[model samples]
Target chain A: MSTSLDDRLLALIDGGDDAEAIQQLQTDPAARQRYLDLVALQIMLHEKLEGDAAVVTPEQEAERLKFRALVWAGALAAMIALAVTAWFALTASDVNHKPVSVSHSIAMISDLSPDARFADATAMMNLGSELMAGPIHLTAGRAQVVFHSGTVVDLTGPCEFEMTGVNQASLKLGRLEAYVPPDAHGFTVQTPAGVKVVDLGTAYVLHVRQDDVSDVRVTEGRVLIQTDQEQRELAADEAARWRISPSGLASLEVTRTTARQVLIDFRGEASQGVNASERYNVFDPVGAWRFTSAFEGTRLFSNLHDVDGKPTGISLTSRMATTMAAGIAGELFVNPVDGFEYNATTDGVFIKGDPDQHHVIFHFDGLEPGGKYAFTFAVGLEANNQVAPKIALGASTQTLAPHDKTRVIAFDDIIADAQGRIDCTVTPASPGVCFITALRISYQALQPTQERMNP
Target chain B: MAGPREPEQFVQHLTAHQTRLRAFIHALMADWHRAEDVLQETNAVLWRKADQFEPGTNFHAWAFAIAHNQVRLARLRSARDRHHFDETLADQLASEAIEQFADLDHRRQALAICFDKLPKKQRELLARRYTANEPVTTIAKSLRRPAGSIRQTLYRIRTALADCIGRSMSREAGQ
Candidate 1:
């Protein structure tokens, strides 16, 4: 299939061998054939490399322009795509001749799904894709909707939301800060008005409200809010709210609220101290005790086996449990000799046998291995540091608020022979509010035949 | 005084000869990306030494000389430690590479008929070499073969390809 001088020269050129040796080979047919042989091999090598070449996207193309040059700076001359180049140039030049079109204003939203229309009706973003919904950066308004996952979206004021891409989103929604991480399957949101803003992987919020314009602000992270027309990004310290009737977004000024105020606003004004309770089977002597709030407390419940002998940790049970407010940063401590920790601010406390601590040295006797144990917790301003839990168990409810004396609750079967451990750690929710206490807990080693039930 | 500033001038100069130079560098390095690196360095040198470029001279040849050095620098900088072709070798290669690409014109004429006759893999391999300008080692790595063996196979294939292209071109020309 080999040919003559000019023909070999042509073949050599096609093989990316634009060298004088090739020209010289053209002078000598034998050398030309060898040159042709060498280049044809190289061409084959190049082809075998691209297993499945993917078409580059615009952003990818721009990035590639930056990195690829440093890689193959002058390896191959690109045969310019004359048609595309000509068309672009022609369009660019002609744009100067026409009058500019009027700009449109609209809100934007986007999500991380291949078919997700958060970006635009036409634009579908895949997982990790980002899309901007509108041209005008939303400076203000209220947008309420439900998100794909369990996320709620409510932007009631001014914000500039920029859509960087499908997965990358930015929100300048002021005052309100809510971020949903891409865990599990997706994320969803429900605004106060029941508007749904659901995202398979992200969450959104509003700094400004639709009617009652509270100066909501975003201090960190971004929230993707749906505007009347598109998706927008609301960034840190930026506030956005919605205006009624015409239903548009407008920028709003902010007054930074205190940490407590921020929490109260999110939770609601009717919030009382937090409280919770649970039930336990004092095994071998199978019986149930009515556990009550021993003191004003922040947290309640126990990591114990359930009715079916399965383990369940911490549950909000009674009105006492519900009314107690354990400001996320309430202080708590445990008493090792007795059993239970008390929250100073709410004066609430709960007791669990040492088995929960996995301590082999200290545990209530007759507590069966793998048996369910229930505990309660409460925290509120009105809680008296009384031994309510002790009283409920037919023991003295003394040592309430204003009295730091320990209440004696004696129970026989005090055998501490267990192998498992429960390390109770308490941490303050805010900087200057609370401190935590620790305890070493253990459980009786289950016999080989004992089967722990699953709840 | 008469020409543009360094970065600007270099950009303009590159834009002018980018295609040809890219093809030449592709042939020399057997990699489009590496060729691109050499092009950038060539532009950088051109920009830095704008004073050395005499006016009304063959800028192409002058730029080519800088490109030649850049190609060598590129080879040295490359992870492959590929053949660091000297200026003379680069010049020889650049010119020859252009000649080889000229065959593409003929191939285009017979492409429709010849494309169908060639094996799909071979045609694709030809496209990767002539169109994408990917590296031999890159291709070999994907193919899971020793680079030396890949090179030998490519050399053989090139011979066959040249024969195929020639026959197709002649047939097309006759028509």
Candidate 2:
């Protein structure tokens, strides 16, 4: 039982050398038992350390202390407000005046989970309860609020939103979908980015990222976006993204096709295609490749569907652009679906391509020469130390940088060749493998006429 | 499969074992935030698959298995950025952690007793280190002590607590 070995083992564990540590443990039974015991103890200690280490800034600590003190003051203020309202009600009744109530029911909680975690347990949100203007934090689980003016909002957790008024709410953070009917036409949502999105009889999904950049996607009708510097309107299927920098709202981009849905379902079955009449065929692709099979010299992947029992006038020919060593053509494996813990169902193709001259040329047939197409693909990190790979779709090339979270990169309006040859070059950042999933190329359709109107 | 239990009964069972299930997930994942997310996801799955779970059986084991699968799925999904443990290491740790769950209640009680035995200053230091999640460097800077010394103190405290728990468990067995 050398303490030196134990220390080395613990250091190794922290440095993520599990294989070596396990190997050493297997050789010594006593040390293995000791390691297990220590691991259990470590887990308990980590459990106690529930708060994130990176979040404890000096300013945040000071704010927390101030918040604790303000809680008492807030309680006292609430009591005083209650007393004043009661006194006013009694005096007004004696004078034949209308009695005033302290709390106004601004919105009703339409839907919420019973096990949803709330920031304040005392201020639990019950279904159909009239919620007054205050802070509502859904730490976990989704909740919906229906305002008195017929506006309905669904909040996805861990969201924090403050109910400012009957028709207005400031979303401090998180994702929310608001459906404003004609009666509640002027429902407004304020974000931390200083931008206020007012509904003009629309259903819109607003997401406020951790960096204070808000993205609003209008699914139906229109929305009036008002920032401190400028005001704009977003119609149906349009998306507006604006970031709040130190200087104020900067980098604002409004486009009709900024956010596109995955046209081809590559989740389980490979070689799936979008039907011409499908709802998602707005940006229809001539063909799609679901690279299910191995690269055997050169292979052709057919489109999922066929018109009139014949080929769908679209196909993809995959061939090695540059020949490398035998095992360099990235491994094709099925990635399990996240969040669905049970049911070991494989969802999508996880391609781990090699670093250097491992290039694959996808020749998409049946496309007009010089046609504008949007090539979108999702790249994810497969190993801890792996750098995001650089990928080129046609002429548009981008280095997929390592992100804190997984994201999709879309190359828009790239002109294809007469024969529709799209060269996909995968240059890995590091020796480790990078994941490529949900590859799609769609023909960019013509934009509808602008429907901008002054409200 | 047996008929689905009453909704109230199912909820009660879930609530009763929620903490232990979360702890089990945390043990396997080694990331608390990720573990919480997995726990919430598991809860949703449990409710959806309630019919699959037979009543009067080992609900804890069933739930543990689901959580285990969830941890695996999450690891698989985020395999690139996950630095802590690979699938093989996670699976090994998970099996061992589940075995330790048999004496979890006993160990918890022992920990509580050992925690009470610490001095007020040491207890406060533990609270600051653990509950507040303040790094050793931060705590050391505030207390005007070396970071190494603070880490050493914490290591010694944890070792002592582990020893105390072991002694308490042995005493209970003797009784």
Give interface RMSD, per candidate: 21.9, 10.8
Candidate whose lDDT is highest: 2
In candidate 2, chain A reaches a TM of: 0.47
TM-score of each: 0.26, 0.41
Residue-level lDDT tens digits of model 2 in B33-116? 666667766665565455667788888877776677667556644545644665555666667666666456677667778878
Worst 10 residues of 1 chain B by lDDT: B1-10
Model 1 whole-model lDDT (C-alpha atoms): 0.35
TM-score of chain A by itself in each prediction: 0.19, 0.47
Which candidate achieves the best TM-score against the true structure? 2
- How far does residue A68 in candidate 1 sit from its true spot (Å)? 9.4
Candidate 2 lDDT over A1-455, as tens digits, reads 46555654555433345566656655665654555555555555554443334456575466345434433433433444344345434432221121223276666676664445778889858755568778889887768887666678887778899888767889988888898878678888888757999998999899888887789988789898887767789887787888888877777777775223324323322212222324222212122121323433443445423212333344555555452311111112222211111121212223344556555555666554676777665554433333555667766677655643323567888776877555565555554444444455555654533555454
Candidate 2: Cα lDDT at A26? 51
> How much DockQ does model 2 earn?
0.10
